[model samples]
Target: MKRFLLFIVFAAFVSPALVSAGESGAEILKARCASCHDLKGPAPATIRQLWKRDAPDLFYAGNKFRREWLVAWLQKPVRIRPAGVNYLRTINSTPTHQEKTKKGRKYDVLWGAVLKPLKHVTLSKQDAGAVADALMDLKPHTALVAGVTLDTSKKVSLDAGEVIFDKVYGCTSCHQIEPGYGGYTGAELYTAGKRLQPAFMLSYIKRPKNWDPKIWMPNLHVSPDDLQKITNYLILLSKEDFSESN
Candidate 1:
């Protein structure tokens, strides 16, 4: 009986400390997330510098991601960019033994670290909320996101959007429209509308080079008309419940 009472007393003291640790979002991020991601940034200035990047910069995450998306992603981490953050590090020239595609094309394949499953630090639901709060606190690029707004006046059907992405811009070569439906270099487009702020999307797509000078995403030289349509399409696409279909 005396041992049981002592054990209960220890648990009472330790449990509160554990809860406090879970609530320390800023501390958690500094300790855990600071290693790979750039919490502070002036994005890569040269191609060499870009290739050296180990992970995405989170300095502008507040201007980039939706809070709910951030929370959920933290709790159950998944690979958003298929070729990984630094594709230059992940890609390898096609091996001689590898079979060619039906079109007889032999393209480069992803190798090295990305070949393994995502290596992000997963968090408990409570900790995820705390970490997300800390991430949202980082908004260094307010000027970049300023005055940018989604052009809701434009409307494009899903079929029309696909044509623009696949045929017009050739975006399907990198980004996926549905699960496993496109190349493995870029992020999945299906959830972008929900995950990203429309303003950030518009700005980033307008000139990815401006956001990250050495990023593999090129300046598509997209016309304003097409830009509005593309942003509209992304918003429409985000409305679809991909989880249900997948």
Candidate 2:
């Protein structure tokens, strides 16, 4: 009777601690984030599959984001991509009235839920920290960022960077340098440096399809020198305060 009582006491006190310790950041991810995001990914294999995606793939988030940025973003969830992750669902055909501008050219207009503010589930500071810790544990694409380093030696003025982004590469068509500018389908570029690791930015820009197989971003075949300049430009851009403009 005495031994049984002792065992029961041990189980009651120690088992709960064991269970709590086992309930890690990964469990938090599975419980809360797995519903909307792709926690396990080979990325979308087809355009149809890509269109069906509801949220960004978090499987490689540790490889992609800065931990500080992730914590901040989760606490105050905001729209990073002007168009939702699935732009196919958010975009509409050109309207008749606006089909032809004074230049008599056609253009597609944004429609649906994305035009409104972001509808993500906001987290409390503590929860956000926990979630960020969980997300940082996910690092499936480690090889992609290997040996990649930010080239700080290269220097490009903001104006020169804009020219490269807009004229040389035409990235401005899909990504925004400032709020209310550029296309609606891709992520905002102004904050890319702040949000992403330098290695990740370099790697992803080199080959986006490698990261998300069926993603809409096409390889622009940027040269090595231009790539260095572009990445440096993004870091410079991040330093500028965009609260007033954004």
Candidate 3:
């Protein structure tokens, strides 16, 4: 009878601790990621608000990211944007001496914090899986991605895709297709295939204002056929081995 009483006492003491230890993924995200990313949102209303943001919003993460990619990325976090989330904070407006040689053409260059290596929160494999699960649940923009259909039938070679991206759309002026290869004002395009969902990419490319009201990326009004080709090309490009070049 005394042993039975002792057993009940031990169970009462340990139950609370076990419950605390097994925290839900949502709780973990609220504790760790809520500070830097916007877990709850109506995206920034204006450019001023956009510039004020310190990190990317996570409220639409489910619609934007691939689950497997999110799981891996959370474990080994890296910078997706070369110029940081707010490029204005990292850019230097002063014209360099090299600009003098270019017929007095002034250019904004990335300096200060952006030139340094990216600093981000890293997670353990188990914690990363939990966080990814929580992020995947935040699909507020289902309507935006609904109409986007990735068509793989439009077969495009890498060379043809580069022509459309660079020569046709002039995307190379702001975004890089490879490391250190293109201009620096925008996010690197090389990793877009693996980092973002196909539907998000197509929808965003079709209309930038729908996703981000004040984003600088303009709506290029890409045709439906071209959009499919471009998306397919991005997916194909992600499979390439750029390690040797780097």
Candidate 4:
């Protein structure tokens, strides 16, 4: 009877602290992140809504992001998308024909605010981990990742991966395979392997429209083999040390 009473006392003392720890992170997210991130469900419904999005949707972050990456990134927050979240607001078409390499082809390039360094909220290590934990609890798209799995056997060489990303799918036209080596419209691909869950990457690549119906990324209609290859390539690419040369 005495031991039972002691156990109950310990539980009473510890439960509240555990709850408070989780709540602190959630409260921080509400106070700071809710203003910019979409912690709630259902992505932008219309083109107008999509254009208005100032940050990436975090409603499905639990399923999308790798926890360690989230914790680290939140601490030293940097811009992932070179053109910012809404390229429509940052890109401008130059009037001069010299801006174009081909006749009658005007290129829209990033300008103004996007060209400037990113301004984002930074959190302390403790707070970042707490917030990442809270964010991980917001998973609503579990179904998206349930059936997907990474197939490492399908891995391709870095050169082969580059060929697939650049020539086959033209992903390099939007996403960067290496720093400053691709278009600024999409988020940098170099970090995708470390920052995102492999299953999420596979599912998103399989059908991006399912995640965000109005997202600008077109359905590439990737074959199953290519899907595995691409996902494997991304995972392998993440292991490279780009900092060595830089």
Candidate 5:
């Protein structure tokens, strides 16, 4: 009884601290992100401007980003999206629209080009760490997924998704989806659905090279069924209740 009481007391105290920490993350995001984002308006114009960029649909931040990745992102952002030169007939090695549209290149040329390290174009180490816990709590009001699985329900087969993820589309060559693939040219997708929406994934895949054609990742062929299967696989990879924890 005494131990339980102490535990309850600790929980009571810690919960408030956790609340305060969450508030701090909101503040930090405001100070760092508000100028560039508004969550409601004309959407962003450039991925760089935050105000201009339409990359992150932060309305789903809690749903999409992992606590650890979000924190690290604030400190040393890793570019999740590769370059963008698809629509434009831009010249060689010329910065793609995606690259041009983002807000940090000035920071890059001025602050990051020095190649200090941890090259994601947004946030410093200290700030990044602070944002993690807060961001995790920013969950959407939606209820649940009934626990996506690899072996149980027969809606989609994990092996099928794996086939599409690695073989048919050639996704493994650029993006790292699992421990097996060795590609590092693009952002890692090992936990994509955990951090991104299925619709968003579909759109991006449908138009892979559009944002940055010149970017190293080549837009490859993908079928609608394959896309759905892959999306299912991504969701499976992202969830926590599954038996096959990678």
Candidate 6:
């Protein structure tokens, strides 16, 4: 009965375009996304005075996330939180992923297999390629980093983006910026401003699969204004360095 209820809830949130296992995080989160992920701003804490909470925010997912990872993770969250973000068990941790032995509850996950679900409907090789092209297509806000020279119209601002960058989204963990900012799993993004076509990037941010099939990342609700900001910010970095055709 519980699982049946879960399935019903799952169908409500997942994208109709996505083919699921009929039981995957994509389905669950998509159904219940509004409860935890608020796009208007940083997700609200349960309390008026509280600023932090347990789950990660999804509002700024457009600015972060690798498309391939996002698709797979949604289809099978066994790699993202292992035991599940809500449960915190590491039930599916791969031998290759980072371990929690050193930090107790503070385990750091650096990498995992590109998710491949035995039960779910996955993107075909051709579709996968199209999606990857689309994902690599995202451009962040074209703002000036402290040391980088990413100024296109000279109106881009990274200061206001601090929350979206470091705290609200934790983008620095996977993506890399040139003068600074980066992570391990994703490609370098300092030059994302110049790498992608503005129009293409726009399509991808709005509908990510216009670029790639996700693995470790999940689709988060995004608004148009935020998309413009991230696009502008990425363009700025393009002034310093970037590539879209690759």
Regions of candidate 2 where Cα sits further than 4 Å from its true position: 1-24, 94-106
Better of 1 and 6 by lDDT: 1
Q: Superposing all C-alpha atoms, what RMSD in Å does each candidate have to the true structure? A: 3.8, 7.2, 6.5, 9.4, 12.7, 14.3
Off by over 4 Å in 5: 1-26, 33-155, 209-217, 239-246
- All candidates' TM-scores? 0.86, 0.86, 0.86, 0.86, 0.44, 0.35
Candidates 2 and 5, the one with greater lDDT: 2
What is the lDDT of every predicted structure here?
0.85, 0.86, 0.84, 0.87, 0.53, 0.46
lDDT of 6 by residue, 93-193 (tens): 46555466745543445332323322233454444444344433333422311222222353447665544555655666656655334554454556454
Which predicted model would earn the best lDDT? 4
Give the worst 10-residue stretch by lDDT in candidate 4.
96-105
lDDT of 3 by residue, 11-84 (tens): 99999655644677798788778898899998999877998898888999999988889889877777767888
TM-score, predicted candidate 2 vs. hidden true structure: 0.86
User: What is the model-wide C-alpha lDDT for candidate 6?
Assistant: 0.46
**Candidate 5, run of 10 with poorest lDDT:** 106-115
Clashing residue pairs for model 3: none
Q: Give residue 213's error in model 4 in angstroms.
A: 0.9
* Model 4 clashing residue pairs (backbone): none
Name the TM-score of candidate 6.
Answer: 0.35
Q: Is candidate 1 or candidate 2 better by lDDT?
A: 2
Superposed Cα RMSD, model 5: 12.7
| Clash pairs for candidate 2 | none
